[model samples]
Target: MGIKVNLDEMLHQRRMTLTELSGRVGISLTNLSILKNGRSKGIRFSTLSSICSELDCEPGDILARDHSSLEGED
Candidate 1:
């Protein structure tokens, strides 16, 4: 299975910049960049909560699961 963060798309859709989101969410720009670039291995609940609150979006809006490849791994 794999997880995908659609943050870039959402950011585009909302016409918001990374710097703006970082300030609004109170997360460091580097960390936010990592998340946006899908380089983050995990995310803290508090961070996720902050992002959701700031973006006014659900977790689903930012995250997605893909099980198709995993299904063939066995």
Candidate 2:
């Protein structure tokens, strides 16, 4: 496990669609889709800022620590 994106849940809680978020965030649907699905390798702070602003949430709300993998590291 790694950093898990919580975009799906946040979108659902806001009753907003990906399409709508894309428009508001000025990000392409394809890119947003990738991020939303947790398939993105990374995200720029500007993009993240836009998303957080539009969604009315913080980065912590959209990203969560996946501690399961840490247990085996040591």
Candidate 3:
């Protein structure tokens, strides 16, 4: 399974820019960009909470699990 971040989609849906979200979420643009691009390995709970608060979205809306795995069945 893999975890996916749909930050870009959410940002578009909310009509907000990455720079604006970075400022509002108290996170650096580079770090936010990394997270947005799915290059981030992990995110802190506090940071996630701040992002959710600013975007008015839940964790489920921002993240999803993909069950397609190569190690499972043949």
Candidate 4:
């Protein structure tokens, strides 16, 4: 994937569990897991907003470009 989710790192740094984030964001564990595990195809901006709000982070803190994945592109 070209985009990497830094969710686990953020959660660890914040001393919070995924379950707690789910509750705070009002999102399901399964959905957050999909995102955390980098298995998601996409994310809704509202969902991203809610997560950022709870985690006290910017979108860049959660998402980053996988520069290695762009190695073959022009």
Q: Which prediction has the highest lDDT against the true structure?
A: 4
Q: Give a tens-digit lDDT track for model 3, residues 1-74.
A: 66779999999999999999999988999999999887888999999889999889998889897576554532
Clashing pairs in 3: none
Question: Relative to the true structure, how large is the alpha-carbon lDDT of every model?
Answer: 0.86, 0.90, 0.88, 0.93
Which regions of candidate 3 are displaced past 4 Å? 69-74
TM-score of 4: 0.90
User: Which candidate number would show the highest TM-score if scored against the true structure?
Assistant: 4
The 10 consecutive residues of candidate 4 with the worst lDDT sum are: 65-74
Clashes of 1: 0
lDDT of 1 at 26: 82
Candidate order (lDDT): 4, 2, 3, 1
Model 4: residues with Cα > 4 Å off, grouped in runs: 70-74
- Give the worst 10-residue stretch by lDDT in candidate 2: 65-74
lDDT of each residue in 25-48, candidate 1, tens digit only: 888999999998878989998898
Per-candidate TM equals 0.85, 0.88, 0.88, 0.90
Q: Which of 1 and 4 is the better model by lDDT?
A: 4
Could you give candidate 4's per-residue lDDT for residues 1-74 as a string of tens digits? 28889999999999999999999999999999999998998999999999999989999999999877766643
Candidate 2 segments whose C-alpha is farther than 4 A from its true place: 69-74
| Candidate 1 to truth, TM | 0.85
Residue-level lDDT tens digits of model 2 in 1-74: 58889999999999999999999988999999999887888999999999999989999999997776665542
